[model samples]
Target: MDDWRSQRIFRPVRWRSRYGRAESGKMHGCADLPGRMAMARKAKLGFGDQATTLVARGTRVTGDILFRGSLEVEGEIAGNVTGEAEAGAQVRVLKEGVICGEVRVPVVVISGRVRGDVYAGEQVHLTASAEVEGNVHYALLEVERGARVSGKLMPAAAGSGGDFADDAPTPGMPAAPK
Candidate 1:
């Protein structure tokens, strides 16, 4: 008897977008390049090579945090958050997140409320939902429409060798004397 599996015709698989939308069968096209690049960047940023540490919602952290890879905050951080400058590290603050102290990282993406100074060695992206009450220091800064900043936006000096202390005082702390 002939096997039924041998009689069946193979059909090409169709891919879907992240939201389950059907996509055209074209492998690569100029029309799809931007979306694909954005997806790739998002995936890379969301899930990096190093470990990811999350501060879940409804939680509160009271002390300084020193991390190497990625840190996503959905709750509240009451102190400084620092990351390695050479590790391509990133810090993301969610919409419900709040940081009452300083943030120092290579990359920072904020969609919440930050009440302190932010220092990014590489870039800082402030989404539409982001609200900053203090200054921002970055090599590259992108502020989306509707993002609010109550303080100064300072571009990091070129060839300054990554010193975060030359800017200003930490939130709720005394300024450093010259």
Candidate 2:
């Protein structure tokens, strides 16, 4: 754990609890904190059926990517990504990752480079290593020291009724499940 923290990659804002951990706002230990992760519930399939989720790391994907399940990105994507996670699925962009397009997700933990627009339907987490150079639309946003966002920010657009956007349907804010 000490080595991980010393690497400058284990920053707090870069870490998130899996399985709906953010609702209670309890701080977990590390982004690389290792444990038996809960089994991801198998998502359904079809166009809107919610089957496939993609995570790109150390790779580059051109063109738009549309999926139904959750996506956790740690690489480079050159286009837009549209998907839904079960409340706590995080789209984490590591310091080495670079995204060059629009991102629409429920929760995002950014620690890398984003060259386009970002839309966080639930919350946006910006770590010290994050460098964003475009517009952002988020319901909630958190930025640490050294994090840079050089664009417009639109907050809490869930209730605005625009362009297929809708609020999260959960009764209360989701927290990481124990």
lDDT of each: 0.85, 0.68
Clash-forming residue pairs, model 2: 20-175, 20-176, 21-175, 21-176, 23-174, 23-175
Task: Give the range of the ten consecutive residues with the poorest summed lDDT in model 2.
Answer: 36-45
RMSD to true structure for each model, in Å? 12.0, 20.2
lDDT at 109, model 2: 82
Best lDDT among the predictions, by candidate number? 1
Q: C-alpha displacement of 49 in model 1, angstroms?
A: 5.0
Report, for all candidates in order, the number of backbone clashes: 0, 6
TM-score for every candidate vs. truth?
0.65, 0.56
Q: What local lDDT does model 1 show for residue 126?
A: 100
Judged by TM-score, which candidate is best? 1
Q: Which lDDT tens digits does candidate 2 get at residues 1-58? A: 5675565533345333566564221134433333332222222234334333545566
Per-residue lDDT of 19-63 in model 1, one digit per residue for the tens? 998765333334566888999887877654687899999999999
* lDDT score for candidate 1 against the true structure: 0.85
Once fitted onto the true fold, the runs of candidate 1 whose alpha carbons sit more than 4 angstroms away are 1-49, 161-178
What local lDDT does model 1 show for residue 24?
Answer: 58
